[model samples]
Each structure stands twice: as structure tokens, then as C-alpha cells.
Target: MLRNVATVIWDGVAPFEFGVVCEAFGLDRSDDGVPLLEFGICAPQPGLVRTSLGFGIEVVDGLGRLEEADLVCVPAMRRGDPLPDGVTEALWRAHDRGARLLTVCSGAFALGEAGLLDGRECTTHWKYTDQLSARFPEAKVVPEVLYVDSGQIITSAGTAAGLDACLHIWRQEYGAAVASAVARRMVVPPQRDGGQAQFISRPVPEIDAETLGPLLAWISAHLHEELDVDSLARQVLMSPRTFARRFRAETGATPYAWITAQRVRRAEEMLERTERPVEWIAGEVGFGNAAALRHHFTRVRGLSPQAYRRRFACGESAESA
Candidate 1:
């Protein structure tokens, strides 16, 4: 049902974040059977708007365009730049008329300024989540996820997460077949759950001789083994308690969580590249059985193993195939 879309910009807009909305909604995908949206870019005044990267974009539509939009988008803007006059009022009008509002990165700040985020769960780029929370005490800021869709408002984390959110909307509005088609054209995964971590485990050092780096690499390669805290502790010559504490400190996740996440990632590769059965893959990835694999894969990737394989196997689209 989302047919009309508009993005409002201000001085000092981030080009990449703005482009996310344009690519998702502004592009004509009618040739692929995706519905064409009436998309437009608007500003407080119709003219050239300065970008954060020292470039400018000519926006020909004014705030009035948002009146007819089914969805209104706001992209990242410089932190300290003043919100254009009437921006908040325009947002309020759009919301009052039942149009969904979406924000990418620091664009949530504009919604915060408009008081639209009050009593709503929202998110922004991880770098600004704390500031968004501090500035808007009533807004529930979920910092660790890729995006948050709270009914009438949607807020996404930094950069590429915006595309994830847009795909989610497409899937909701047009079904998975249509969404997958759009994603195929964009050359991205058809679906990435919003619950997925905004920041996954940081890359471990490849050649560290004096840290847990070597053990971490070994764990990845030996994912088929029954990895437990005590065994891992023994491998690193540390007590279980000490190893657990240090692993959490270094990886920002518990040993169990980290290992489980890695196993899911490995399973994803197997699903994408091989025609392996789910039970076999589960055992190879240390899940022991297909049930456990399905549970964790669904929780982490928001899809069943079979569904993931269907969508991604052999690097071909399930629909097309």
C-alpha cells in the first residue's frame, strides 16, 4: 500500500544516507514487476541544499510535497545544523495524516526535535544512540539492532542498515517475492532481520602471539568440535572463570554467544554454497541437530535454514530458479 514516498532534506545532509532512500524508493523497478512509487525530494524551500560533503543537490519540491506522500524519509544531517523552519510542523502534519515516517542515522534527531519519537521505540546510528537517548529522554533508543519499526515510525542504524529497513518495508508491502526481486537488482541479501546486531564481533587480530587471538581463530576453524568454556579455557591455559571474563571483555560477547554466532555464520555459507542437508550442516557447525540449528538460525538471521537455503543457495534466486 506504500505507493508515494518523499524525502526531506536540510543543509548539511549526508549524501550516502540520502541515497539509501532514493535507491530503495526513488528508483524505477517497474521492469522487474516492482511497483513504481511516486517519489520526490523536498526541502524547506525549493533550491540547492548544501551537503555535508561539500556538494549540493538541487531540490525542486517544497515541504508541501510531503502532504501527498505515503512515506516520508529523513536522512542523516550534520549534528549541530539547525532544523529548517517548518520542518517539525511538516513532520507533524504527515504523521497526523497517517503517513509513516522513517529516519536514517542522525536523521532521528529531526524526529526527536519534532517530538514524534516521544513514547516510541526508535534507533539511530550507534555512534549517536547515546546522544539520541540523552536528548530525547522519552524515546526508547535500541542501540544494538539494525533498525526499529515502531508502528508509524521507523528508525535505522548507520549507513547500509537503511537499505535493510527499506527492504523490510518492501517485503511488508509487496510480499517476499517482490522484495526479493528488488534485492536481486540491488545485489544485496533479500532480507536482513532488524534484530541482527548493529555491531557484530570485531575482527580478531590475525597474528597475535600473546593474546586470545590464536584461540579465536582456532575456534572458528574447529566449529565442529563440542566447544565449551572449560575446554576453551584449557586451550588458552586459563581457568574457566578467568577465560570467560576475558573473552567477554575482548569480544563484547560471552563465549557461548560468540561461538553460537560464528556457527550460524558458517551455516549460512554452507547453505549458500552447497546443497547440504540441514541435519548434516547442523552437525558440521556443532549444532548437533537440525532443531538446534533452526532455532539459532531463526533467532540470529530471522529465517529458517531451509528458507535461507532456498533464497540464497548456489548464488541463485529461489524465485527465478
Candidate 2:
């Protein structure tokens, strides 16, 4: 459904952030049965654009191109620089016309300038989250996740997180199979939420091994087993209270939260890779029964297990749904 994507660039744009946007949408992957996206770069002045990294990229497209885009992405810009004439107004028009909007890192400031973020749940780079909050007092700025998708308007954290945000849109619009294929092409995880409960079932892209790492691996290996705060605390050689505190401190989540996420993640994999019945998958993932699994899966993913499998399952047999 999101066929046309236009990325807006301007003076002082961060190159890496811009490239993340380009890599996410600008590449051709239809060879893998993914839709070929119509991606382009647009600039307000329609010529050479200066980057924060001391280089210039020649952009041939202008804001006029943005008018027809299904989605408009803005990359990180000079934190406090002036927006070019008509840039902010164009963003407003895009939003007014129902175009999807996405921002990476300090690109959020551009949305803030257009008054799009006010009263909407959004996020930016952790370093700039406070500043974004201070600048746009009405916007709900969530500082701790890989990205935030408040429906049509999506915002991501710093750097590679932009990839996650883009893939999220892709998964929603097309399906998980398409998103996964694109991710494999990019060599990045299709989804990662950094242990926040809201982004349930999505794994963190990667983690460096430590005391918490071994615990996480153990939990993943035994998701169907009863895993409670007290039981896990004993494994870690600490009191339940201390274990909860330490888990949150190290992983940004509580013991119960992590285990629940792990179970949901297992459900997702089974739903995608196997044709097992919902009741069977639910019990295997430790949700105990279909009713309980539906409650948590719907609460977290906004879709039921059957619907998720129908939409995301991998092969021709998956079409049976």
C-alpha cells in the first residue's frame, strides 16, 4: 500500500542517518518477491545539499515530488538550523492529505516544526529526547525504545533503529515475509524494541554477553517452563526484590516482563514457520491456553495469533489461513 516514498534532505543533514533512510526504502528488492518501492530523495532548494559530515549530495528532486509520496521521511538535520522556505508547510500539507510520515534521530525536530508531533506519542535519539520534549511541550516523547509507530506517523531512535522503524512500516503494509526478506538483504534485524513491554515479542537486535546475557539465553531456552520473579531470582542467587531491581537496571525490563516477551516471541516464530493450531502454539509458548494467548497477543501486537499467521506465515501452505 505504501508504494511511493520520498526522503527529504536539507543542509546539515547527517549522512549516516540519511543513508539509513535510503537503505531502508531506496533499494530494489522485488527480485525476492517484495514490492519494488518507488523511492526518491527530495530537497527544498532542489540542488546541492550540504551535510553535517562535510560533504555535499546533489538532489534533483524538489518538494513538488513530496506532494505525490505515500510516505515522507526526514533524516537528522542541523539541530537548530532554520528550515528552508516551504519545507515546514509542505510537511503540513502531506499530513493534511494523509501521507505517512517518518523521522530518524533529530529529524523529529522537522516534524516538531511542522506541528505534527504535538499531542502525539513520538521519540527521537536518546541524547535529543529531552531537547525534543522541551522544544515541543505537547508531544509525548518516549526516550527508551527502538521506535514509535503512532499509526501514520512513525518516529525512530538514533542510527540503525531507523531500519527497524522502516521495516515495521513494511511489515504492516505488506506482511512479515516481505519485511523479513528485506531485512535479510540489509543484514539487519527486522524488528527490535530494546526490551520495552510495548514492543512485545520483538527481540533486541543484539546484546553483548554478560551476567544478564546468560540469564536471557536460559530464559529463551525454557520459555514453556514456569518462570516467575522468585524462581529466576534463585537462579541468579539473589532475593526476588533485588533480582527485579537488577534486571531492570541492566536490561530495562523486569523479570516477568522479559519472560512474557520471550514467550510471545516464540509464539510469533511458531506461527510463522509452522502450521500448528492456535491452541497448541499458545500452550507451547506458556500462555497456558488459547484464551490467554489471544489476550496478550492482541494487547501487544494488535492482532490475534490466527490473524498474524494468516498475514505473516512463510510458504504456500501458509495461504490456507
Task: Give per-residue lDDT, candidate 2, residue 250.
Answer: 65
Which prediction has the highest lDDT against the true structure?
1
Q: Which lDDT values do the candidates have, in the order given?
A: 0.86, 0.83
Query: What is the per-residue lDDT of model 1 for residues 35-79, given as tens digits with 9 covering 90 to 100?
Result: 999999999988999999988999999999999999999999886
Candidate 1 has its poorest 10 consecutive residues by lDDT at: 312-321
User: How many backbone overlaps does candidate 2 show?
Assistant: 0
In model 1, which regions exceed 4 Å deviation?
204-321
lDDT of model 2 at position 99 = 98
lDDT string, candidate 2, 172-228, tens digits? 777666877889999986655533532323244235523566887888888777788
The global Cα lDDT (0 to 1) of model 1 is 0.86
